[model samples]
Target chain A: MDLPRLEAILSRYEGESWDLIPVLQDIQDAYSYLPKDELQVVSERLNVPMTQIYSVATFFKMFSLLPKGKHQIKVCLGTTCHLRGGGRVVESLSHRLGVEVGYTTKDMQFSLETVGCLGSCAQAPVMMVDDKYFGRSTVDKVPKILKLYK
Target chain B: MVWKISDETAYDTLGEEVHLTINGVTIRAPQDQSLLVTARQNGFEIPTLCYHRDLPSEGHCRLCVVEIGEHPRTQIVNSCTYPTQAGLVVQTHSETVLQARRMVLELLLARTPKAKLIQEMAAAHGVYESRFKTDDPEELCILCGLCVRTCREVVGVSAISMKGRTPDKQVATPFMEKSSACIGCGSCAFVCPNNVIPYTEKEGIRTIWGRDFELQPCNVCGNYIAPKYQLEHWAKITGDPVENFFVCKDCR
Candidate 1:
């Protein structure tokens, strides 16, 4: 991340701390994760502390302070979803992925996470593979879904 | 045809423009238009909540996040507030964006278990359960701000504004009391996507020009289970008016 670009982005959100979220979001959008060097630059340029930056980065579920795999798998665990077997889907993914939630596979092929809900409960037990929605998922479908991703 | 022009001078003022690409589709828009609006206008579908055209964009719902460009990489940007800029690229359906949107929907579903839209959207997203604690508390308002925005912007009555902050924010009349400014037009209820408002009426009472009847709860369950009109409406829609189906809370 360029220091000048970071400063220019930060300049647009002068005097507003809440803008920090969006700014960080923009940074993450550019890098896939908040690069440590950029975080330092943002800390110095925005007059925000590095620890504060890290805290804010980790505070929201959206921000990723570390590198991620090429593919990100998000399983929906909303209530109607949960009742409809969202948990089983996540468990199956976790077992198959062999990495706990928030961790990338050693091969860097995938990262798994459980998400709140996607507001499509009628299609409960949903998992998002890359950009597509795989609804009404069952534990049995995990292998097929993972195979498609690979 | 002699049409007298008004004395007011009309001049076109062009503001700064930004260019961005969504899912490989190039677009140009005024810098102020939210990415969501721009994308939708250009035929890119991005799902959103707490985002009604009538309401001020309150990015609390976090459902419209999208991935943008290749640089200081942030995977998800709230499309509702993100400004487009020259040379910027956006992916409305990126892997990251889809995941984030699903997570947001899941969280909302955990809080509002009975909202039909939430259910439908969750189902569409393939959510079956909230991994978090299930607060299956029955609620209708997904807190999308459409009602509040419609009341203020369309109705010209700022009777209700979102109260509180994240994790506790909600649309409510001031102090959570009956609003004096509320014309009782039921626009809030009418426009609400979640159907969270509970309309109270006594037997033989009339409300908003419609006949009112006591909504009976299930005799066994005691859930304010059935609205009389809802039952009648369902019967009309389904053409099955079996009175026995209208069980009380206890029977249900």
Candidate 2:
């Protein structure tokens, strides 16, 4: 949001167009989400088009356009996890939080989402609340997990 | 135009050929030709779905994979993008190659069982049924990305894109909203392998991917001209007036 800070981020990339993805990742990391104005600045600095940058940003699941909440919730719906009641975990979290996947709560307390896999198939039906992994998660455990984050 | 053959040796040096074997048959082809092209030229019929001679190969379909060598072990690679080199031993229809191709076709069939192209390919490969469940019966777009590549590389306008991670990946606009950048060129529809992208023209109205454009009618006859957005795109690029394109090509 600040011009000086934006300029500092832009200067980190040495005007190399191939560094566009990493530049976007760094910008998202600094601001928690990609801002439109910063993306415009990136387009101009890298001599790339806005549509091209937007394509890459929207293509990857890692990037987010909207400001994320303080705590992130990722439910694994992988083949193993889904067969082990991972869908129920997502539905339970959605019902508890009153916000669907990819949306943050109105109070900015939590953001709910789903991922392909976390590579922890041993811990089937896993849900990650921020950095902590909740293995063998259930609908009854949703409230307890939220309480720990808050 | 008639003055040619100045030197026979000069002509021979200008054009060099690469020799390769496909399915135990020897063939001579021009240097740098893709394996698919060389195979096709020599009468070896390899099934392919996502490859087009005009566009760059993305190799997403994995149907044109062929066994590359016999030393140590053979490796399967997409023949559409693989270049031809001298003395390369390639088998277009080995048992391992057939098994891999059948598996790819089965996966494609599971995703888009209703697609006639997929059904035909599946039947040809003897993959009569898919072990995987079909998420959507009417689903199309095998995620081959031919349409996306043609739009970006040929049309030069990336109105649509492929998004999300694997197993949940889909081709759509950013956020799946109507893209303001789409010019309704129908190049995506033209290049689609399974006719996935919905396109229809009725009563001088054209709709593609849920965006409607009023078709420009020819001034000479009643037949419809190109979509207004397509002509507008051409006008914007060439600095021509929209009125100039009202006349149909037949009249022009």
State what share of the real interface contacts each candidate retains.
Answer: 0.00, 0.38
User: What value does the lDDT take at residue A80 in candidate 1?
Assistant: 86
- Model 1 regions more than 4 Å off: A1-150, B1-18, B166-168, B200-252
Top model number, DockQ: 2
Best by TM-score: 2
- Tens digits of lDDT, candidate 1, B49-126: 677765557686888898886756655778887766677788877778778878988888888877788888888888
CA displacement after TM-score superposition, residue A80 of candidate 2 (Å): 13
Under CAPRI classification, how is model 2 graded? acceptable
| lDDT per residue as tens, model 2, B1-252 | 122221212235333687888888888876666788789878899999888766677788899999998856889999988888898999999999999999999999999998898999899889989998898888987988888877776776677777765677888864566776788888999888888888998988888878898998898996888888889887877798988988989999
Interface RMSD of each: 13.8, 2.8
**Listed models, DockQ each:** 0.01, 0.35
The Cα local distance difference test for each model comes to 0.71, 0.83
Q: Worst 10-residue stretch by lDDT in candidate 2 chain B?
A: B1-10
Clashes of 2: 0
